[model samples]
Every structure is written in C-alpha cells, then in structure tokens.
Target: MCDFTVAVFRPDDDRLEDAVELLESLGATPVPDPMLAVEPTGASPRDDADYTILTSKTGAELVAGAYPGTDSDGVADGGARTDRWNPGEATLCAVGPKTADALRERGYDPEIVPQEYTSSGLVAALEDRVDGARVEVARSDHGSPVLLEGLEAAGAYVHETVLYRLVRPEGSGDSTELAAAGGLDVACFTSSLTVTNWLEAADERGVRDAALEGLSNATVGVIGEPTGETAVAAGIDVDLVASEATFETLATETVELAAPTYYE
Candidate 1:
C-alpha cells in the first residue's frame, strides 16, 4: 500500500499543527507546509462603529489579545492593540463560528454570526440592518474585497482596519517541490492568498509550470468558492471545494476523495 500524501498550506501556528494532526488521523501522510505568516499591525477595530465585524479567529485574537481574565472590557496587552477597546454599544459580528468563539474567549459577545460563514453571507445577514449604519471591519490585510464592497453596496458606511498582514513564511516552498515531483495525493488550499502564495513560491523556485502540472494530477481542494476561483484562474484543477469553509471539512473531504480506502 502506498502512503497517501496530502499537502496542507497553513500558518506555522497551531493551525498548521492542527492540519497535520487532522490529516494524519485521516490516514494520510501530512505535508506540513507553513505558507502564511502573520504580522501584527498594532491596530484595533474602531469601537465607535454601530456594527463591528471580525473576519477570522486571528483577527479576533489580535484585537482582543490572548490574555487570561482579559475580557473585552479592557484593552488586551498582546497582539494588535489600541489605547482601549470598549465596544460601549457596538454590536459585534463574527464571520463564522470559530471567529465567534475566539471573540467569546476574549470576553466579547458577538451578536451576529451568519449561517453561511462567508463574507457574502455576512453581508446578506447584515444587508437590511447596516443601511446608513457605521460598520467597522477588522481583519488581515488580505481580507476579501467582497466584504467591503458588499457592505458599501448595502448602504453601510464601512471602514476597515488592517489588524495584521499575511506573508509567505521563509523557506516555505518545499511543498511546491514535492508537488512538482508528483509526490502529493492531495493539496488543500484554505484561502485565495494561499493559492497565490503557493504559486508565487513555485515561481520563485523555478517550478511554476511543473508544480501546476503536478497539481493537475493530484486532488486539489479549496476551502471556499473564492479560493476555488483563484485556483481555477491559476490553471490549477480544483477537485473539491469543501461544503463548509473550514480546515476540518476541507481536509476530510480532500482525504476522502483522494483515498477513500485510507480515509475509511
């Protein structure tokens, strides 16, 4: 029996570790590639907005800080920071359950979490309510333009604060070489940035065409439709777009599709 190798591009933090663990548990050889690195921008969400939106667990942690007993009442002393973060009367909104949980861990009670768990879904969830309302969006620099455009189109006065920037980690292209060698059975992309970064890394390594060819032969999975579009635009055949926009869903579906016998 051959090893079912699955390549995952996540950050070096617990996310990457968690991805490896999930892949291993699903009976696949995990290619742990830390593609995304987070850089804090020392910025926090505007508290004066009528509705404050947080797009990811990383964003929530950056704004609220990761300290014990440091609920959203006071400014956290870690990650991104402002003088203070007192929501006062702002209704907190999270893009998904994990982000909402991160906010809750920091003592924030997010009032709105869309069922679809995407930027468009959040926009739809707030479309009727945000008209003429001040909406503050806080997230990474690579956050989707759909979020801001949707909010603006819905008549919301939207302001965005870059809480962090995501960059490709140093020496992160090993997976490109592996993929180009046709050693991977599956590759999971969590965001459009990951797809762009992977290709950029491949280009830098002078294996862009070979890597794309290899991905064509392997099962390529993206977490969301936006990511799928990015992959397709790059000429990478997408084998699966997870029904849910989550790592577990993406990995589980990818592993099952790539090697159903091993996954079972």
Candidate 2:
C-alpha cells in the first residue's frame, strides 16, 4: 500500500460498487466522486444500417436498454422482445474490451475492437474496410467528432444517434479539502467530459486555480490518449495514460504510480 489517496471521477452508475472494490484493492483510501451525470436516451438499432459502432459501455447499454426484455446485462426478460432489425446481422464495432463485453452480454458479437482502445485506433484499424460502408454510431452527446469525421473521410456514410446526455452534477470535486489536506495522490479520469466537467465544477466552486494546482501536484491517470490530451490542454499536468483504455487498467496504473518509491 502506498501513502497516497486515490481520487476517482466515476459518474453515478450501477458499477460503482465494483469501482470501490477495485480502488480498495490497491491499498489506498478511495474518494469516489461523480463529475458528470449520465442520462440514457431512447436509441435503437436501424434496419438500414450496415454496421454498428459503440464507443463506450454506456452506449452499448443504451442500445440494448432501448429494446424490451434486454436488461443491463443483456439478460432476456420474461417476454423480452427485439426490433425487426437483427443486431447479429450487422457488423459490430466496439472501442474497448469493456464496451465489447457490454455488447456481448446483449447477445451481439463485436467483430472489430481495435488494438488501441480509442476512436483513432478504431479508425486506423477499420479504415480499409469502412469505405463505401454505412456505419451507425451510437454515442453520447459529448462523444468525440473524430470517429464521424474519420469515417466520412473514408467515404463511409455515417448515421449517428445520441444515446445519452452528460450533465454536470450539483457538486464538483473537493479541491479545497483535497488541497488543504495535502493534495491527492492520484486523480482518475475516464473521459474528456470528466476532465471538462471537473474543471467546470471547480470553477463553479471558485476553486479552479486551486484545483488545477492540486491536480498538477498529483498523478493524473486517463482512460485513453484523447482524454489525456484533453486534461493537458486544460492546464492539468498528466502523469499516467493507461496502456489500455479500460477502467481496470486505469486503476492498476494509478496504484502503480502511487507506489512508495514510484517517483523516487
């Protein structure tokens, strides 16, 4: 166990209990906080779509959640029903293992999960195939434009639907308390929205500068490269970028960075 406390930005989700257990596994006190609130909207499969793209686990959940009989784990209800469209008939692409797992639980097999867990990675891996294909991307309103732009550049017709909206919750990060308590040991970031929302929350609490200063002193861990880039662009010094853009990897790397002799 290291001498640092691990702070996480986990939005209100069903997996929060698992997250807490994960944080505790690293032998540190966990301060799990929600920087953004996720609200899933009504979104479903399209019959005319040639392929399906899911960028996050939330998007996968939303797609399955829209249909009757499909629960969060994709379990069939007593009289679960699906649309006339067959998800199995369409090519499924997920950004990472967690996202793919979500789809798999819904009985949809993902054919494309990039070696790198990111939009650019997905594009790079499927660039040669997306040309002349019609891709249906289910994502949040805060999703990156990179996927859509890259697919369009590859001459693929894209039909994107917003499956969720991310809103900043009432209270933000406790930078004041953290800074006053000798700063944090690690700060976990899940997405670009998490970073933006944290900054906004801090600013709203009139502690943006103090928050940034505290973060600059702590190790910043990002789920993916784009998120790390977002944090850096926002004047937040970054320390760890997960090799795999998954929560498990993020937690592992955060704990590693917090080792007693990590910076020594």
Candidate 3:
C-alpha cells in the first residue's frame, strides 16, 4: 500500500503542524510547501471603540497584545471586555483552537453564534448588534473590505485597523515546491489566496497542467464557500468542503474523503 500524500498550502507553521498531525493520524503524510507568507503591516492602533471585530487569527494575534491578558490563543484576561463578537464562538473563528483557547485563557467568554464560520457569517451575526454601535475591525494590512463594508452598510460605525500583510513566501527562488506537489492524492486550499498562490506558483514553475492533473485525480478540499468557488474558478473541482471554515476542519474532511484510499 502506498502512503497517501496530501499537500497543504497554508503558510503558518503552527497551522501546518496541526494539519500534518491530523492527516498523519488518519494515515496520510503531509507534503509541506506553503505558497503564502504572512507579514505584519505595522499599522498604528486606532481609538478603543465600542466593538472590535477580528476576522483572522493573524489579526487576532496582532491585536491580542492590545487586549492584554489575551493569550496567543485569543483568551482574554479575566475582568477584561468580554462582549466582543467572536464568529466561531472563539474556536473556529480566527485560526484554530489555539486562538480560541487563547481568548478563553485571557478571561473572555466569546459570544459564539451558530452559523457559517467566515467573514460573511460574522457580518451577518453583527448586523443586529452593530446597527448603531461603533465597531473597530482589526485585520491584516492586505485584508479585504468585505467585513467592514458589510458592517457599515448595515448602519454600524466601522473603523478598520490593519495588523498584518500576506505576500508570496520569500527565499523561495522559484515555484519548485508547487511543482513537486503534482503527485499528491489530495490538495487542501484554505483560502482564496491559497488557491491563487498555488496556481500562480504552478504557472511560474511551468507545471500548470501537472498541478491541474494532480488535482483532478485527487480530492480538492476548501475551507469555505468562497475558497471553494476560487478553486472552481481555477478549474479544479472541489470534492469536499469543511463543515466549518477552519483549517482543522478542512484537514479533517480532506482526510475523511481520502480515507478509503489511505486509511483502512
């Protein structure tokens, strides 16, 4: 029996580690070759507002410092503001358990709402709460305006703070890492950017066809609907989608889909 190989495109080592551990436990091997690199934006802090909206774990980590007693996992210090709107109930909201646990460790019991775990879900959840409140959105420097835009459209006072930036991984001379992913049994794309970066890297390495072919035979898993759409746009058929928009769920579903082939 051949060892099932899975390609993970997330650039965060911590995330990559968690995915790899999950896949391995399910009888799959992870091929580590990230396509994106997370860079901090160094944006100055804005005024403390009524509400703080965090979309990504990266953003959570950056602003985690601002909310002292907030651990790396998004936990807030006891007695700190705890009415913040955490999309995934703090767990699946930002990055993964670590971020959620961090928030809890600090002292916050995030308001978890049952819904799709994504920026859109967060927006929908905030519609009623932020209609006339001042909300501050903290995100990556290159983050999208989707969340903030939606908030304002819903009559909320939205202020944005850039916390980080995402760029192509540095020191990677070429897209060789992507080219080598051609033989994997499954390719997991966590974000729309991951899809773009993967394809871009493939094109740069002149292995577009190879990458596509590799994807064709294997299952393509996406973290969210938008990411799934991005994969479809890239001409890769997504076979599985994580129930929740989180890397952990994405990897779990990917492993489950490919289990028959690799796991007994």
Candidate 4:
C-alpha cells in the first residue's frame, strides 16, 4: 500500500462505501468522512410537466421507491403504482450518467443526459428543446440556481420540487482533524456544498485554521470547476479537477496526482 491517505467526503451511504473500496483498491488509505446526509421530503415530481429533470441518484431512488412495479434494479415486474406521480408523457432528463442509470433502474428512460454533468450543462442540453415547455426539476434543496434561471431564460416554465434535503451529518468532521494535523495526503470534494460543509465542520470543531493549514500540504481535488471554485473561494488550494464530474474519476485522478508512482 502507498503511504498516502485520501479523504473522501460523501454522504453516509453506498457512495461513501464505494469510495472507500475504490481508494483501498488504489492502495491509498481511505478516510471515510461523511459530510452529508439525506432527508427525503416525501414529495415527488409533478407528472403533468412537458419535461421532468432529476439531478441526483438519491432523488431517483427515493422516487422509484414510491413506485410499485419498479424493482430494485429497475426491471418492471408488475406495473407502476397508481399512487405515485407517473411520468405520463413528460420527457425525462438526468444531469449525468449515474442519475440516468438510477432512473433507468426504476423503469424510467432518461431521454436527455448532458455530456457535462453540471446545472449549466443541463440548461445547454435543453435550452432549444424546452422553450415554452413546462419543466419540473426534482432534486435536493441545495440544487444550483443556474439550472432554474437558465431554464426560465430559455422560455421554459420551471418548477422545482425538493425531493430531499442535504445536511451535515451529526457526527462528521473526523477528516477535518486529520487534515488539520497534516495527516491527510489527498482530499476529494464532490460538490460545492461538500466543500462549504467541510469548512463549516472544521469551524465547528474549532480547527478551521489548522485544517486549512494541513490541507495546504495535501493534494486537493474536486469533481468539477464549480466545486473547485468553491474550494478556492474558501481559501483552499485545489490541485485537481476531474475531467469528468464523477466520483470514480475524481478519486482515481486525485490518487494519481498524490502518488504518481503508487499506481505504476
């Protein structure tokens, strides 16, 4: 195993577990610090919109769980539950492949997935298609404003449903201590909220300055440019931005940057 340690701040779920396994496979010690938690609102997307968008895999799963015939893997066994909001004639869209996959698993076909996974990318993909259309966006409460504003500017009537809320988990921030102590070798931040919540965690622990100092000595990587900007705005130096906005690519590239010889 390499001597480097990589801190991953994902939600406390399969994403975090998958990150830990991926890091261990790459020979870097994984610091499994969950900075986010999901709170479902029990509100589903509107069925009557001309276009419906889902921004996260968690949102897809939460909505899918409400359906009857959508199996865990998305194979339809019986039929979609009548009690839930069916897509009807709405064209479904996902912000990225992962979210699209989640939707597919739940028996919904995502007709549009932008090459770029950001909110701006979604707007760019749909700007021409959604003019004068009613669009419903379902995702977390922390979704980017760029999506709503861009859609509205393109002549689409946009309504957003907060499928879930992302909050800092009660007992997170162990990685802040490790980072503050200069024990971290690399850190992978997946979103702007992750970056903000992490610093907030550091402040809550009274180690904000120390954590920033420690991260200076470690390689920092984010999933996209927005997240990178957030880190920079928070006085954190980001050494890498994954070419793709996915955790697998982010962790792999961050590991390679931290220990070039480790993978070889």
Q: Against the unseen true structure, what C-alpha lDDT does each candidate score? A: 0.86, 0.76, 0.65, 0.88
lDDT score for candidate 3 against the true structure:
0.65
Ordered by TM-score, highest first, the candidates read 1, 4, 2, 3
Model 3, stretches more than 4 Å misplaced? Answer: 65-98, 106-114, 171-182, 262-264
* Superposed Cα deviation of residue 2, candidate 1 (Å): 8.0
TM of each candidate vs. truth: 0.91, 0.86, 0.79, 0.91
For each candidate, how many residue pairs have backbone atoms clashing (under 3 Å)? 0, 1, 16, 1
lDDT of predicted model 2 = 0.76
Worst 10 residues of 1 by lDDT: 67-76
How do the residues 81-121 of candidate 1 rate in per-residue lDDT, one tens digit apiece?
Answer: 43335676899999999999988987899999999989999
What lDDT is reached at residue 158 by model 4? 96
Best by lDDT: 4
The alpha-carbon deviation from the true structure for residue 263 of candidate 1, after best TM-score superposition, in angstroms, is 9.3
Clashing pairs in 1: none
Angstrom error at residue 41, model 1 = 0.4
